[model samples]
Target: MARAGAVNYLFGTRFYKMAYVEFGNPAAPAVVCVHGLTRNGRDFDALAEALSDRFHVICPDLPGRGKSDWLQDGLAYQPPTYVVALAHLLAQLNKPVSWVGTSLGGICGMMIAAAQNTPIKKLVLNDIGPYIPSASLQRIRDYMLEAPERFGSMADLTQHLREVHAPFGLLSDAEWAHLARFSARQVLDPTGSGKRIAMHYDPKIIDPMRAAVPLDVDMWPVWEMIHAPRLVIRGAESDLLLCETYERMLKEGAEGYVVADAGHAPALMDYESQARIKAFLLEG
Candidate 1:
């Protein structure tokens, strides 16, 4: 079973709420899973359930996404804001936690893990690494900017997700359906129409990203500072985390796993993917 909850925190002078889902007993070892840009905590449903028996798995929707409150200033959507908010979340949990982050979430994890006395005990970066090519950043920015504002129906939304997230690897119809169900929400159409489906996140969240694109994202210094045991998961076909980068990560002492036939990311919805992640996190 999963329980949904929210935490209210002050980001500058404004207060925002971040929503999250929890699985398993709170007394168990904590594992925090964070999603990519344009994705929410629910994306971890299958993975969290798989690990629930042995871990207290927590998946949080970063501010401006899912059930979390959108920031008044779109610029607040950067990694710094997320670091502060997530730090607050960790404080509330009051435990050292293993971290599993995907894409942009992985970047946040890296920043936090690099900090002095971070609570992260183990780190798993999914489909992302310390260095991101400028081309990949530009590609992601274009995709987000060109996304549709509304969909006529859930099927339409599902189709769109399938096309854009083709890199999520091979997911079953049921799995795709699960993604669609949680990826959107019903809202009154702007034209005084009945109702329409909209992406769960705030569109303005892309503001800072638009400003940062076309430039490589470099974080090797941060990566070097992290002393926690690390695991890097990359899609074999992913342009975001190149093979050379993956090899370099391995040489730098981080364990690596490549998900074949996937592109930007490998959704850990499959049994094998979940098992690999589980085994790593459980390692002594």
Candidate 2:
């Protein structure tokens, strides 16, 4: 059920491998998807299938996550490098593409949209914005660092995700199973347990935070600079994207909507959310 491919980007002298999934016709209009922090490209499998008939969907696992190659220098995992890597990915397609970014992914689209002569035609920012609350960042930091290294079974991993990500609103059992299938990779079990499942991403991906200093940067100007049509999907109780910022995004002409009973980030797995995105993309 999974159809993913890899591409290599030569950064300086070394090459980095990026993993992404594609669905639908290549000749159709393209939609480039990016996942949130600690998540891989497979997170968008549902959304990709829903939109595939009308759009060519590309969902990438940012470096250090999913099937993508990990970085030797953790500092290079910043948004700017991601933007460049994505641009290269799209350039290979030789066509402009719409963007759907969630959390850290949204910030990548913002940076690319603000740059000169970019290929982003439309943007979807999911539960994130310029003024990221440091509180949420700290929460993410502590949680990832303390998460269990691996699970004895896929069921165990799914259960862990259920408790930790309950704020993504209620997902059906099938949905959770889908997530668990992609979230872990089979590895040689150290305890000779016959190939236990481990998280798919590099644990060192958070190393940048250890040596980082705090800074507050206003992103109103950059947000304003983007000319493409935008849609902002906010989880009702999201600690990431504030209501005030969502309002400002609306004032700046970006369409806005809320996914009730959700928090932090709304996973676009539900019917209502996919339908809204479909309508926006098809708006006349």
Candidate 3:
């Protein structure tokens, strides 16, 4: 296992604590792995550990998720705010960084890399593409809305993760347990009865999705603006990354990998998936 540490800092003027886990040597080249919506930084543990030998890995729990501070105003969860927060993180690194992002995290990567003079040197966008249909997006939002914020027991939380994230494919019992452990927090059960567990993220992290009228936005312009070397990962069964758009992205000169037996997103925890990402990032 690679050496690791937890670090936190105050970003913006809100004093919201931005937390992250760092792996490998600080002197090595950097790689930043950002997680999907409703998921936190720990999602990258396996991937980070795998890459730590060659790269310094940083996995940040975007505000309102995991160990990071939650925002009082849900509206602050928008992409612009997230982009600003990322800029702050990159500045702190004081060096160019490679990025690995899943789902919402991928979208965040696109916005940052599309900007003028971005610090992102290379990028891996997992299970997302330049565009997704409105209906597919609505389905994602609906599922999130249905998820219970608090669980009565570890069993309840693990069961819920299994159902919704079944697309992660066949993970070992230990893998599932790892997710359940890091994905939740023990909190006062509100009923004043002992304690219950709640999902680690702020429920309002989905506010932006809920508030918007669903529309199929054209993201090719965003895709085109990115000049860094890039790779796009698509789940074989993903509804969010349309086959047509993904193909177009590849034809547009970006490299792509399709993960088998997965949908919506690839967790990047499996060895094969990690190998694909590793090869892309390490290529000369």
lDDT of 1 by residue, 1-284 (tens): 88999888889997889999999999999999999999999999999999999999999999999999999999879889998889889989989999999998899999999999899999999999989999998888898999998888899899999999999999999999999998998888878654399999988989998766478878889899999999999998999998988899999999988888898989989888899999999999
- Clash pairs (backbone) in predicted model 2: 238-264
**Candidate 3 to truth, TM:** 0.94
What does candidate 2's lDDT look like per residue over 54-101, in tens digits?
Answer: 999999999988889988888787787787678779788888888999
lDDT of 2: 0.85
Candidate 1 clashes: the total is: 0
List candidate 3 segments past 4 Å from native: 1-13, 192-195
What's the CA RMSD of model 2 in angstroms? 1.7
* Per-residue accuracy of model 3 over 9-39 as CA lDDT, tens digit each: 4445665567888898889999999888888
Which runs of model 1 end up more than 4 angstroms from their true locations? 192-195
lDDT of each: 0.92, 0.85, 0.85
* RMSD in Å for model 1: 1.1
lDDT of 1 at 26: 97
Query: Ten consecutive residues with minimal summed lDDT in candidate 1?
Result: 186-195
Candidate 1 residue 210 Cα shift, in angstroms, is 2.5
